[model samples]
Target: MTVRPITITGEPVLHRPTRPVTSFDEELRQLVADMFETMDLANGVGLAATQVGVDLRLFTYAFANDDDAPDRGVVINPRLVLGKISEEDPDRDEEAEGCLSVPGLSFPLKRAEQATVSYQDEDGVQRRFEAHGWFARVMQHETDHLDGKLYVDRLNKRWSAKARKAIKREGWGVPGNTWLPGRDEDPFGH
Candidate 1:
């Protein structure tokens, strides 16, 4: 599978909702494989189709929990069901989050503690699963990408202002600000 170039913040594809996956053919399988490869190369736990310039409602995730139990899969045309947070425990926790589209930047953002997603597999089979803690956060983050939203959109006002300034300074707010893995220069500056 080839690692596709990741689109940056200013790309229109990343800002608009993606279309549902209608065909579960070899082309779709290759796209999913390529997404996994691209996500791995970028060192991202989760990636959406829009991040790779494919306007389809699909995402791939590779995550390991505290015990090192690996969780990897693809979600196509997902529907999320968030669990209610306790009154004493706020839904918004200060946790660090980053996006492949907006490289070299990370900030603490609030996310749900639990989520249950219903989605189809690569073979068009229905599946449902629950995620908690970091897994839940990752699911939320990736799902947002399918909806044409980013982690920055959920940032608090203070962090949002800081992120905007950094985007401007780094010249990342324009389309075509992309880097291919293992070929182009490191955009994160190592």
Candidate 2:
């Protein structure tokens, strides 16, 4: 498997809604493998097809576990069918998340505590799986990417401020000396 370069924040493809995958050909399978490779190499838990400049609705995610174990796999044309809500918002449990596209920076974000998702597995078999805790968060994060969303958009005001400053300092979207604070930071800070 080959590692594909991840597209950065300014790339228009990252925001464009992904097209559904129509074929599960060898190329698509290989792409999934390569995505896993790249994600592993970059120490990312999830990656979306659009992050690699592909417009298809595909993603790979791995649950973060000790012993350096990799629970790696893919989802093709996946759709979220259900989620569980605890008395506490699962996503409000803040943890540091990093992205392959947005390199060299890690910031805090919240993710769902539990979720039940139904999607087509690699062999075109329909599968329904229940996940909670870290696995649920990974699924939520990667699935959001398929819908053209990013975790940074979920940061609270204080966290968003810090994240935006770091993103800008890393030169993510702006030319040298250009400061676009409002666009750079999460205005809503939800």
The model with the greatest lDDT is: 1
TM-score of each: 0.90, 0.78
Q: For model 1, how does the per-residue alpha-carbon lDDT over 1-190 read when each residue is reduced to its tens digit?
A: 9999999898999998999999999999999999999988888899999999999999999997542224888999999998764434222335778888988788878777888888999999998887888898898999999999988877777788988998898888788878787787655665
lDDT of 2 by residue, 68-109 (tens): 223766877777644644433223335677665666556767
Which stretches of candidate 1 lie above 4 Å from their native place?
66-70, 85-94, 185-190
lDDT agreement with native, every candidate: 0.86, 0.68
